[model samples]
Target chain A: MATQTTDVGQAVGGAAKVGMPQLDFSTFSNQIFWLIITLVVIYFILSRIALPRIGGALADRAGTITNDLAEAEDLKSQALAAEEAYEKALADARAEAQNINVLMRAEIQGQLDEELAKADAQISGRTKEAAAELAEIRNAAKANVKVVAKAVAKEIVAALGGKADAKTVTAAVTERMKG
Target chain B: MATETHGEAEAGLVFHPMDQFQVTPLFGAGPVEWFTITNATLWMGLSILVIFVILVLGARGRALVPTRSQSIAELAYGFIYKMVEDVTGKDGVAYFPYIMTLFMFIVVANFLGLLPMAFTTTSHIAVTAVMAMAVFLAVTVLGFVKNGFGFLSVFWISSAPLILRPILALIEVISYFVRPVSHSIRLAGNMMAGHAVIKVFAAFAPLVLISTGIGLVVTPLSILAITAIYALEVLVSFIQAYVFAILTCVYLRDALHPHH
Candidate 1:
């Protein structure tokens, strides 16, 4: 079938009769001519346009990757620093709370001590006043007892029908109390 | 492709494997003039168009995150660039575009030729020879320019004993001159041989229709063989292009550093 299609062109000269078409020198010039044109065209396309564009693209990609990696590294370091600052702030807040607790406890203790001292002084003063009152009552009772004794004696004497002087009776009662 | 070969199905098994490689005009049954737009021109032109599409238009989107075709373009560029740099060293990076041109052309052309009934342009000696010769001449001239008369030291073996140096030099000189020949023939031969072998196996595919007994075994075997060979050919296509480019770099290296 290939021969049938290509068979149409064998009607030229007797020199076309050859075992291999590759050895056919007649087509060399045509092949070489076209080949040169093709090579030159390809060369220009590659050198002037295609290769440089590809190289540029590859280089551009590499540069972009490098820049991105560097930026990522910078962000990572920044995050670490921020974490350190946060930890320090937390520790500072805890220390401040501790200081406030100690100060508040000391201030409360001072107020309690002052209140207790005032109550103790009031109790002692009241006790002394009560003791004085008690002593006065005892003295009054003792005087009353003597007077009653003298009155009873006078009544007895009157009942016996011997009317005597009050002065003398009082003197006698005083002497009995002394003895 | 199966339909294309079916035309000769009725005429019994006919094997014209070499006919696929013939260089004929795409238009009429006329002479293949130097300027004539033959099948060779069609395929070569197609190769150029493909290169333009893949390397130029395909990679139009220069995205930081690449699209499919854009990545393909970058992959090809890096592959060739690395090859040239590895084989020819840093100074050879200047000629990266030229080496890239050859690599892209051959690689794409070879793959295009893998299509059924498609003309394999790299299968021709004329085409591969021209490319190899271009590399050879360029390297030779660069050697002379860069190293002056010291370029001849490439063939001279300094490490060898003085008694054996002449013999080593003689061998090196022959091998140096043979670079272009081996380089061109190797690519063309691999391509031509693979395609011809496939065609031969394809011719045997219709054996089942002719005779049932032997055709059962021969037909299936040939088809399987075709599959296997086609797979191998695909590998060969890329490898051949790689071999060509690497060889070119090796030559360039020798030219640049002509010593040990």
Candidate 2:
């Protein structure tokens, strides 16, 4: 405790110094020798253990950072790929929907066309039958008119005091109608 | 100015700032032997222990997300590592451990010295000189071994004009030899000067008890100066360590690539 005022002194009191202790040649070897030993010990400890450990820690941090960045980049690309696939799928679904619409429209049109064609066929057939029936009625009416005219001619001849045969009257009437 | 007696029956203010640098045996007062464990040894050993705890033990977790102490350890490691790689190039990374050892030791020793009444090991010329000399000798040897005679090209600046090349080489040689001396002195001088100045200011702080008249002015001023200087010393100590390490890198670069 008393000698605590050595160079690494605990003593704060002023003890007179002779010349410069640094310039004092007697203590040079002691300081130099100790410094050498301190340095050697430090060098060995650092080289053997401390330096490598610290260096490895730093390197490990860098590697971890790099790996984390790479993983982030990879995830970003994957997200991009997923979005692209979703867009493609969406586009495909839209196209399929349009295709189904076109197919449905065409089928409905074909069905409508078939119904119109069948209706046309049925109407034409009914018109032809009706025309034939009108022709028959016209013919019947003409025959009836001719018979009535023959009867009337006969009655008129009898009333005018000129007696004639039924066969003759019929013949006359038929000739008139022909003219 | 040295000690002075002011009045009878009163202890005059004593300020022996240089006395703080005196080397003495930690055990007992006697002649310091070459192997005697002095206060210098105690502080150096303490610094090593500090480094071990902060670096070796602190980084033991090897966490991807570092804790506070681990962060400091990794920060120092990365700072010096990047500096070495940048200044010394890729090949110089192999000497990172040695450089880190020097950096940690010096910086830790310097900060430890700032503690009240603690010995400043790095302030000693003997200590810094050895480190600087070691760097110098290692770089010199490595240069010679690696480049052989080609290492001489570092001194011979072929980029200069023919006439100036010899002069420049002479200058380069002198500068190269002076590197160790300047490197060591720069750290030691800065540490010693700052501490001594603080001690000087502290010695004046007692003026308040001695003479209340001047003490009123000198006491506050001296105290303020000590505070300010103490803060500056903190910055200086760290800077000196960084300077020393970076300078080592520069020297290593020259050795590895002596041609340029």
Candidate 3:
């Protein structure tokens, strides 16, 4: 019975061994060595080359931003100057127009006054000439009338003979003119 | 009937690829038997090749205004710069190359392992242990170079009272030795556990199919779990890489300043 149990035990142990895979360690050492080597090489590259370039790029970006901002400010100042000049020119033009209008109005008014004066002077001269002609005609008419009256008076006096007094002669002359 | 079922179940369980890749002796040689070119090695090689190509291509044009490749290179450099600055302050600039290289290498290796049929080197204790050991050795050497015998004072807790100095020194020494072990295990354990769980769930997918409608439901669920785990692994890979780099920086600090 003991011998039988031992055989059974051995059978069980053998069966157990069949299912299990053996472990391997050589692979572990190889893995460890290569991991170290790779890490070391990576360290070398990063330290020697990559980092400095990144730092330089960052600095360059900062410089570019600053330059762009300064350029923008300069353009703003130039725009402001242009705006000021434009406004000044507009104001000057407006002021010049006002001055021209004033000068033009004064010259127009002076010319109108001269024309009015010349027209008045010509009218006055014509009136004076007409007045003088009227005066001469009146004088001539009066003289002719006086002569006729005198002739008439002389005839009446001859006819009247003894009624040749001044008052009576005057009264006869007025009665003849009335008829 | 249950005993028979249990026996059959036990018999059906098989050793997986992960078990086969474990750090064990082959053919009864010794611990040295574990050394071999494996999936982990392949992934690591691929990682190096990829990084090398990217850097070489990125740097080739060298234009005054950056091209796309140059821009990518600059971005990577800038990223590392910020990381170093945050971790080590302005003095970190001097060590920027080392930390950046370390971060990229580990990140690529971790990401490569996520590919189908790829080996994760960071998943093995032996591999991660070796890396941590390298860092420890480098930092130790740097400490001695920079501070000479003064570095030995770091273990003594010089700020403590004289009475407590001896005890603090012993504790500090022990903690120092534990650094490499913890660092390696932190990365390796996370990777191994995550991958193992994924494999186990995947194996269940087909087994659940041996049943009828239940198998169909379980299989989809298993697949979904696998997908979720994959996403988590990707996240963990990045986190581990960051942790490793940050820890390396801390160690470098220790080297630069011994007492602190």
Candidate 4:
């Protein structure tokens, strides 16, 4: 600390003249000197090291964010491609199933049509043979009737008390059969 | 309370509110020679040391996910950088370091003063004027250096009527010269007034005991006023620092684009 006299001397010399010490011009150079010193030091620290570090941190964060977003976008596009491929595979499988069903129906219909055609041919051949047999039986029956008629007429004529000729009886019987 | 008042009585209750601002040589008994270390110098140095510790050492880690101290340092850096960039546009960003230095010094000095028994160097015109004058000189020189004789057009009002152009130019020149005066005074005045008001209220804290009955009511009231004013001064300190820095940016903007 300064001696009382010197302190008083300085105080009276400068501060006392001006009501406020701030208005005291005598101390301006000292304040200015320190101000310059402090400012210069602060400027160097901020410019050289402190500011650059902060700027680096900010730039790093922005780069990381951009990189992450790009990766996420790539992943999203890949997922979309996979989904499209899956859908296409599903549609292809459905078309194959439909094709198989149509082929089986066509094959089964061909087999059923072949069986029906064979059965129809067998029935038509049996009806034709039965009709020929019927016609032959009818002709044989008519010939027998004529022979029996001639015999019966001759016997009747003999039993009656009148003589009967074989030629007359045959002629009458032939006429009647013809009519 | 009685003991406190007793101490005050023994020390003589005369309160020298302005005594806190007095500049004294810190060392030997002598006049404050140009180089003599003084209280003002000590506090100014302390402000610088505090800023260095917070910004340089605190940011040494420089983590992606920053520590608390690192976060503070980064925040201050970004805040001033953005301010300078926005106010003066991209071209003016080159001066960011200087502007940032001014902001840090004033803010630190203002905050340091809030400490008990601390000297507020920023409250004096001596300190603030130097900074303001520096801004003024730097801007003026830049304006001239960049624009040559065309720099005088900043004061000329070409848009005004022909008859009024000369008169407007005169007004502009006067206002331009007043920039440093207003800039320095605005900060120092605000700081000094707030501090002095707080001190005045504090001085009254002990005055109540002189009146026996009134002491009970007045002492608490005085304390309350001190609390209120102290809070206001804290806000004032931050605002004044911000104002000084931003105004510097505005002036820098003019230098870069005088047409505006």
Model 3 lDDT on a 0 to 1 scale? 0.71
Chain B TM-score (each prediction, in order): 0.95, 0.95, 0.80, 0.92
lDDT-better candidate, 2 vs 3 = 2
Model 2 segments beyond 4 Å from truth?
A1-16, A148-164, A168-179, B1-11
Identify the runs in model 4 with alpha carbons over 4 angstroms from their true place. A1-18, A107-179, B1-13, B208-212
lDDT of 4 by residue, B64-160 (tens): 7789998888889888899999999999999998999999999999999988788999999988999999999999999999888888888877778
Flag clash pairs in model 1.
none
- DockQ ranking, high to low: 2, 1, 4, 3
The residue-by-residue lDDT of candidate 1 on A37-62, one tens digit each, is 87888888888888998888888889
TM-scores, all models, native as reference = 0.83, 0.88, 0.67, 0.80
lDDT of 1 by residue, B1-260 (tens): 55544544545787777777777778875677888888888898899889889988978988889999999999999899999999999999988888998999999989998999999999999999999999999999999999999999998999999999999999998999898999999999999999999999999998889766667998999999999999999999999999999998999999899998
The numbered model that scores best in DockQ is 2
Return whichever of 2 and 4 wins on lDDT: 2
Residues A1-179 of candidate 4 have per-residue lDDT tens digits of 12443455455444343257788777888778877887888888888987888788878877888999999999999999999999999999999999999999998999888888887887777877777787778767777888898888988888896678989999999999999
What local lDDT score does residue B43 receive in model 1, on the 0 to 100 scale? 91
- Give the alpha carbon lDDT tens digit for every residue of A1-179 in model 2: 12333533334213333446677777789999988888889998888888888888888889999999999999999999999999999999999999999999999999999999999999999999999999999999889988998888878988998896899998998898889
| Model 2 agreement with the true structure over B10-105: per-residue lDDT tens digits | 255565676677777888766788998788888989998999899889888988899999999988988999999999999999999999989999
> What interface RMSD does every candidate have?
2.8, 4.3, 7.6, 3.6
Docking level for model 4: acceptable
Clashing pairs in 3: A25-B34, A25-B35, A26-B34, A26-B35, A26-B36, A27-B36
The better-scoring model by TM-score among 1 and 3 is 1
Q: Which ranges of candidate 1 are over 4 A from the true structure? A: A1-18, A110-179, B1-11, B156-164
